[model samples]
Target chain A: MKQKRMQGNADLQKLTDLAQQLRRDTIRMIHHAGSGHIGGALGLADYMAALYGWAMQYDDLDPTDPDRDRIVLSNGHTCAVWYAALARSGLIPLEELATHRRMGSRLQGHPARKAMPEYIETSSGPLGQGFPVANGIALSLRKRVSQGRVYVILGDGELQEGQVWEAFMTSAHYKLDTICAFINYNNIQIDGKVEDIMGIAPLADKIKAFGWHVVEIDGHDTASIVAALSEAASTKGKPTAIIGNTIMAKGVPSMEGDAKWHGNTPNDAETEAALEAVGTNNRFKDFPIANRA
Target chain B: MYSGNKAMRDAFGDALADIGAQDDRIVVLTADLTDAIKVGKFKERFPERFYQMGIKESDMIGTAAGMAIDGQIPFTSTFAVFTTSLANQAIRVNVAYNNANVKIATSHGGVCVGADGATHQAFEDVALMRLIPNMTILVPCDANEAYKATIAAAKMDGPVYLRFGRIPSPVVTGADDPFEIGKARILRDGKDVAIVAMGAMVPAALEAASILAADGIKAKIVDMHTIKPLDENTIIESAKECGCVVTAEEHTVLGGLGGAVAEVLAKNLPTPLRMVGVLDTFGESGEPQEILEKYHLTYSDIVKQVRLVLKQK
Candidate 1:
């Protein structure tokens, strides 16, 4: 039993390194572009890295390989993390990460289906649309004889759209066992704090009420996220909603938990500091700093 | 009795059931209007594939996109006016953006909706959907055509807008007529003038053809159902053969079937053409036939337009 526990710990440690690499990649990609959503991107970095590295099953060589798992970014504004994870996972070239949000570059400000390969799924800039699209993909996969899962990520702010609730209701009703929703509950949006701007409190309870099986976890904790995702996969007869409790700006000291950092880019000096804080070697050197509204 | 006005909606449900049984991937979605769109039969048969989106068009579209991603061909049903306006973004973003294989089954299109006024009447649906990239716009002429179009859209590879009318016109086309998207079918050939029509106006155009023939004016009638791809070849050929044209439809004069035909003619042949449709007006509550007459959408209207365009030449 101890041996099994140690093996699990070692596996989680590898995921922790993957998360740090994803963070570094996100910061580098956004900093190079001179623009991109940084707050939510940084917050969701750990969760995304964990999913791509371990939770989700996909073939980088053939993205549209019929048997491959699907990951859709519903809150596409936070695409920095997604692009970084994709590159780090060998889905795209690691060197191409620097071209993010640059004109003539495959990477766009938001997740664009035209910009990237077929793996990007669909163009998702306007909020509240991706969730339903993701639901449709999930439902379709469930209909096929082959088993494939669809993972969708959304920001807490994007939840304000009534469409999310509508999708949630339909997902539960259909009992789409193959669909899993990840909510970056980072408590921030473009205007201000999510609570002050649009009180979507009791979000978890609301999802539960809509008949989805809810799983709450730490967004920055790679182990907790992976564990929660596993629990969601094991959940049968209904769709799963994993609410990832996260800090808005996550790593950098000045921007941590600040709503102003949502779309704001850091100065060169600040970027250096942020990179140093996450660690220079691209492995998690410090635990997540817990700060709440 | 649901009235003759509700036959298209009823046909939509019947065809969905007929098609759904043969294809397992055929899923149905509604924005709280399954019964209104007359999708109850399919829903009852395949409860597993039926989804009630509860009046949210945008979300319903997004969910349909998701379903499409998973390899299910989703048919989202709703009133044409509501779907076109409320769910425009969904169609653009979800279906068009990814080029997802989703069918937008829209009923109660145009002034034939009657009694519900302009709000229920869908005049600009064709125009709006036509603007989207990779979208196949299909306006079926009747119940028989609607069923054939539904099946054809299911087999097609991308996003399709299957526009159906509220009232049941004559079943002009044979039950076995194979409906093809982006291709115009010639109903009757003539040597003097060509009448290009779509949706509920095809029967009117056919009647106008007979009236013109009696008056020593040989008329050609073409069902230009797939308006987006506009059947440029057929329109150009018809223009070359007939010399004058009359385009008719149950939509707005702006960017509907007539506009599509005019664009093809203006750029290709520049032949004298007259349009027969709603001219910058909103519809009002009345019976379907009363509204059709009030909008000048009858055999007599087509004949008048044909003579006027003939005089212009």
Candidate 2:
């Protein structure tokens, strides 16, 4: 019994390590691209790691597997981490991450299904729209009796959009328990702080009022994220909302909790420091940067 | 005058119910207009597949797109004004951009919405929907055509915008009349002039053609139902046969049937054309007939436009 517990801990540690590497990759991709959302991507790395590494039942070989789990990134601007996770998991080639945001690159600034339909479920850029779509996917999976869960990640600032509230009502009203939504509560928007721009504070009560199974946790903690996802999966009769408390730029000293890095890309020095901070050796050694303006 | 003819919305509802019976993947969604949009029959028949999306049109559209992505054919219905104008972005991005198999069935199209006023009436739905890529716009001529269009939209693989009216108009097209997307149906053929129309104006165009026939002016009547992927061939053929053309519809002359026909004629045929539709104005609280007449959308309007076009020719 003790051995089994230790093994589980070791697996979680591996996931954490994978998340650190993804964080470094995200920084490198954005730095090379010269433009990308850095903060949210870094903030969402651990959640993506937890989902792709442990929770999701996805086959990189058979991407269109009927029983594979569906992951929708509602905050599509933060697609760097998702791309990194997909690349690391062998769903997409790691070298392709270098061509991010370049013309004809599958790794677009936003998650576009047109670019890569096999892995990206839907083309998403406009905020607060993906959650409702995720609800529809969940409902569809239920109708098909596929037993596949739908997971959606939304940014805290995106909650200000009215459509998100409408989706929240829909998920609960239909009792779409198959949908597990994680809100990256980084408390920062493009312009400034999410609280100052338009506060969605008392978010827990608001979501509970919408009849969702609400769970708040430290988003960066692999163990907590894994546990919350497990709890969400077991939850029935209503959709689960995991409010993942996160920093805007996690694992990097200069940009952590900073709003300026929300959409700003890292320069050469900043990229090197971010990689060092993430503790990833041989940063992007295998991935060759695509020559594009 | 109200014939024993059913409203296009009623036919749409009936057709959806019939289609849903055959294809279990056919799901119905409404923005609190299940009864208003006449989708109640679908709701009654398939309670499990029917989703009441409340008063949120935007959410309904996005949800339908999601459902479409997951391989379910979602037919969402609501007021034309709300669906097109209010939820235009959702339809553009989610349904059209992604090429999701979402059938947007909008009732209460044009100024025929009567006492509901301009806020409810959708005179620019076709124009708005036409601008989106991968969007097929169907403005059915009569109840039968609407029914056929609804069934056809179900079979279609991409995004489709099916527009119907609130008031009960004449059932000019019979069950035998062929209804196909991107194909115009010639109701009457003549050499003097071509009266190209769609939706409620189709019956009006036929009436105008008969009036012109008596006056020694032969007018060809064409039901250009499918607005986008428009039958440019038919329009050009009709223009070549007849020296002049008059486009009519229960929508704005700016970008509806009139605009579509004009586009075809200008680029390819380059014939004399006059448009019979609302002249860039909103409708007020009045009866359906009163509003249509006020906006010059009557048979007499078609007749007048035909004469004016002939004079131009």
Candidate 3:
């Protein structure tokens, strides 16, 4: 029992380290590209780490395997985290992370499936659109009798879009248990705080009322995310909604809880500080300067 | 209720049921309009595959795209207005951008929706659908064509918008007639004028052709159903043969069938042309036939337009 506990703790530590690496890579990619949603990307790093590194079952060699688990970034502005996660997981080349938001690059401002259809299931930029697509994928998986699950990452502000609620009702009504949604509850949107823009208070209660099994956890905690994902997998007869309580800019010290970093990229000095604060030694020591153009 | 007359929506339901039996991957989704959209047959046949989306057109569109991504052929059914206009953004990003294999089967297209008013009638579905990059727009002329188009849409990969009408119009094409995407069917052969039409206006154009024939005018009728990949070859051929063209449809003259044909003619043939359709106005609540006549979408309108074009020629 003690050995088992230690093994679990070691696994948690590995995930935590991976989450920090993802945060570092995400910050560097945004800073190098000169534009991206840094705040949400940073906030969603731990969840991405848990999903790609530990929880989700996907083939690193053949990412487009029909029975592989699918991860859909519904709030596609935080594509930095997705790209970073994909790269870190070896699903995509780590060196290609430099081309984020660049001209003729596969990594666009949003998660465009045209860029990489094999890994990215759908192109998503508009809010609340991804959730329904995830529902459809889950429904299809169910129809095929495939055990594959679909995980959709959405923003807290995206809950304001009526289509998300519609998806919520449909998934639950269809008894799509294979769908597990994670809301990055960072409380900050592009304009301002999510509450100031449009309050989706009583969010967990509302999702539960809609017939989903709801789980609220600390978004920065790797262990809690893994546990919640496991609970979601075990959950039968209904979909799961994990309300991840996360800070806006989670890992970076100066940017944490700051709404201004929601879209703005950090400069050289700020990037150096953020890299140090994220505590990952995998900093870009020889990143190509010519690729910036 | 009458012989050789059935609503395109009913044909869509029957066709879906037939196709669903053969293809297990085929799924039906409706925004709480199963009976109205006539997908009840498919629902009864494949209860598990049929999804009642409960009036949420946007969600339905995204969900259908997702299903498509998972290698399932999802046919989303709803009123034309809600499917095209209400779910425009979702269809653009989720379905069209991703090139997901989603069949948007929209019933009650154009002023044929009648007393449902301007809000319900979709006067600009073809225009809206055509604007999307990877979207295939099919405005079937009658029930037989609608059935064929639905089946073809299922067989074809990527996004397709199949537009049908609420009224029980004439079944112009028989089951044996050839039906292919982006191919125009020339129903009548003539030399004086070419009557190019789509959707509910095909029957009107055919009737107008007969009326012109009685008046010693040879008017050719072409059923240009697929609007996006506009059959420029057939339109140009008809123009070369006829010397003049009159385009007709139940949609607005601004950007529907008439606009598509005029675009092809203006660039390639530059033939004298007259358009017979709604003159950029919303339809009001009335009977289908009453509104169609009020909007000048009847055979008489097509005849008038044909005569005008022939005079210009």
Best by DockQ: 3
The TM-score obtained for chain B by all candidates, in the order given, is 0.96, 0.98, 0.98
Writing each residue's lDDT as its tens digit, candidate 2 over A1-293 gives 00111113326877887888888889889998899999999999999988777788777667787777888899999999999999888788888989899899999889887788777888888998788888888888888998888899899999999999999999999999989999999999988999999999999999999999999999999889988988898898999999999998899989998889998878888888888888854433435666634
Q: Residue A74 lDDT in model 3?
A: 91
- Tens digits of per-residue lDDT, candidate 3, B75-179, equal 999999898889999999999999999999998898877887999988888888888999999999998988889999999998999999888989888888999
The lDDT per prediction is 0.82, 0.88, 0.89
User: Which tens-of-lDDT digit does each residue in B1-313 have in candidate 1?
Assistant: 1223335666778889999999988999998887778889998999988988777888888888777766788999998988889989889988898888899999889887788888899988898998999899998877777887888889988899988876667767877777788889998999789999998898899889999888999999999888877789999999999999999988898988888888888898999999999997888999989988988989999999999999877
Least well predicted 10-residue stretch by lDDT in candidate 1 chain B: B1-10
Question: What's the C-alpha lDDT at position A68 in model 1?
Answer: 69
Candidate 1: misplaced stretches above 4 Å?
A: A1-10, A65-67, A103-105, A114-118, A145-147, A282-293, B1-14, B176-178
**Per-model TM against the reference:** 0.90, 0.96, 0.96
A-chain TM-score in candidate 1? 0.91
The root-mean-square deviation over C-alpha atoms between each candidate and the true structure, in angstroms, is 5.2, 3.0, 2.9
Between candidates 1 and 3, the lDDT winner: 3
The DockQ values of the predictions, listed in order, are 0.62, 0.74, 0.86
> If both were scored by lDDT, which would come out higher, candidate 1 or candidate 2?
2
